[model samples]
Target: MIVVGAGIAGVACAGELVRAGVPVEVRERGRVPGGRLASRRFDGRPTDTGAAYLTADDPDFTEVVEGWRAAGLVREWTDTFLAYGADGHREVSGPRRWAAPRGLRSLVEELARDLPVTVDRPVTSVRPGPVVDGRSCAAVALCVPGPQAAPLLDPALTAATRAVGEQRWSPSLATVLRFPSRRWADFRGAFVNDHPVLALVCDDGDRRGDDAPVLVAHTTPEFAAGHLAQPGAAGPPVEQAVRDLLGLPEPAELVHVHRWTYAKPTAGGVGTYHLDDEGIGLAGDAFGKPRVQSAWRSGRDLGRALAERLLTVGG
Candidate 1:
């Protein structure tokens, strides 16, 4: 079995296959795993620039989160977020949001600990017979964003790939700012409403429980789209918006901008996964809700189904 992409979905699927005694290899284009659950080091501190937090209401996912919590890989970040608009800011409470001290990426890395993951080996194409990058495989799982997976599918699987491609994915520009001091308002994060440039802002210090005076902000999809060609160009507006939102006089000491072409799925996924008779499968957050837990569930379920089919054939 071959799994493309090492995001949560891909790692979860590979983990299940390993547990089922199936030989599997994971290929990731990025230098590291964790596509959206990305974290980077800024000024020697880990900052979550991609996913804000993990929220789970499903029993099975909650149990998995609990296990991660027990292992000290995850912790409850917060249940409330401040919604900012023209009127004012209001606190909205929801399910507990989970965070990892080391970084969100560590969760996927932990799950992929025992799996055989080949980083920097991007599969250029997936043909019938479940061939990946011209290599024949019994089964192939494309656990990446729909837009990304779409181009890789062979023309023969147009129906499957087209359905995956048609799914709308919104882009995002994440700006990370490190201030000289924590002079902002006393809030973990804020959802900016009616903002022309910014959509969300998170205090990296608060989210990681480190009080590091770092802020991570995400631009609106519209704004991101306009600046996709030059992601760094989107930084100034976002920085200005953050400064204005927090009533700050000056910019941060350091500013870094990152671009995500397929940040989130605008619409719900087709289903848990798309497994055609050709033995080609698609699984990811795009196949369900745009959530980390959903990606894991989609991949796990697909991995189980593939394992059953393979086992039956072997028997």
Candidate 2:
């Protein structure tokens, strides 16, 4: 099995296939796996710029999450999640909101390390041509975001692959702030409801690591949309919004803005899609209603579907 893109969905699919005794090779465009579930460093502290926490709604994901928790790859951060309510910021206590003791994204990176992953090798295109010059790939999985995966497919079957258009994703900017000391004493996390530019503010040191103080503020889709058209995925609006939201007195020692051109799901897709004709399949957050659990379940389903198809073919 050849899985394109090493995000959680891709990793989950490959991991399951490997467990089924199927040899899998993961091709990732980035230097490391994890995709949107990515982490970065600041003054030696690792902060997740992508997904903050995951809430498992599906039983399959819950079971997988349990294993992850046992292996120390994941942990229950909290039962309550802070969101904007009629009051201002209301703490809705229900589902188990999980985070990494280190960084949420690190879990993916750790699990994918030993696997056969080809980094920095972006798949330019895929056709019906031979897998090994004539064999036709036993199967190919395209796990990249929709906009990115569309053009890389063969023109003749582009419509079938046009399943890409069935989905839509948004962009966002993450501005990391390292304060001299702790600022907000309310809770570990906060959802800024009324902010024009900022959407979320999370204290990195609260659950992940012990440090002086660090805040990772995510920009609203409206704000990120305007800035995403720029060349690189970084800029000033994101930084300024972080300071404005927290009312920062001055600049911190280290400041970095990471703009995700493809962030949230604008329009949710089906549970998941599989293209058997060309031996290609697709999965991601956009594969369903935007959520970490949705993405995980999508990968799970994709893996099962692929394995079933492979079994029908032969051994």
Candidate 3:
């Protein structure tokens, strides 16, 4: 079996398949795994520019999160955030959000530790026999965004791919800024509602459980779409918004912009996964809610179903 994506969903699926006694090979287009659970370093400090945090209400997922907490891979961030609007800002409470000391990507890396993942090797296409990039395989799982997976699927699975592609995905631009010191007010994070340029901002220092004076702000989907072709251009407006929101005196020491063309799915997909007799499967956050936990569950559920089918056929 070949899983073409090294994100959490892909890794989770491959992990389940391997545990089910199925041989699996993972492929990723990027240099590293984690996909949207992405993290990077700026001036020797790790920053989370992708998923802000993980929230769980489902019992099974909560169990997995508890395990991650026990292993010291994740920690409870906060259940409250400052909500901002034209009127003003106010504190709001919600479910517990989980964060990683090393970075969100590290969690996915840990899950993929035992899997054989080939990075920087993207699958060109998925043929009818579930062939992956011209290599014959019993099955192929495309664990990517709906729009991205649509093109890779063969004509025979057009109906499946079309349904998968129907889900709308919104783009986002994340702006990371490094301040000289912790001059901003004490707040773990803030949700900027009714803002034209900004949607949310996180105190990276607080979220990462470190006092690094770093901040990461995400642009609204509408704003991101306008500057998709030029991500860097979105940095200025985002920087201004951050400063205005936080009331910082000085400008950031360093700033960077990252674009996610398929940041999130607007609505849940048709099902947990799409699998046909041809052995081609589609699984990702698009299959459910646009969250890390949903992605994991989607891939895991699909893996179990596919494993059963393969085992029965082989028997």
Q: 17-122, model 1: which lDDT tens digit per residue?
A: 9999999999999999988999999767888888989999989889989989999999898889999998998999987888888889999998888899999899
lDDT of 3 by residue, 110-208 (tens): 999999999989888887876777889999888888788888887787656676667789999999999889998889999999999999999999988
Better of 2 and 3 by TM-score: 3
| lDDT for position 310 in model 2 | 79
In angstroms, the error of model 3 at 220 is 0.2
Where does model 2 exceed 4 Å of error? 81-90, 129-136, 209-211, 229-240, 247-250
Q: Backbone clashes per model, in order?
A: 0, 1, 0
Tell me the TM-score of each prediction against the true structure.
0.98, 0.89, 0.98
Tens digit of lDDT per residue, candidate 2, span 1-315? 788888888887787777777777888889888888888876676888888788896877888788888888777776755776446667767667787876777877765766788889787777764142133568877777888887777766654466777778888888777767775554667677877777887777775746447777788888788777662344455556656655667666556778788888787465575555666788888877677777766776787788877778766
Q: What is the C-alpha lDDT of each candidate?
A: 0.88, 0.74, 0.89
lDDT of 3 at 270: 75
Candidate 1 achieves a global lDDT of: 0.88
lDDT-superior candidate, 1 or 2: 1
Show pairs that collide, candidate 1.
none
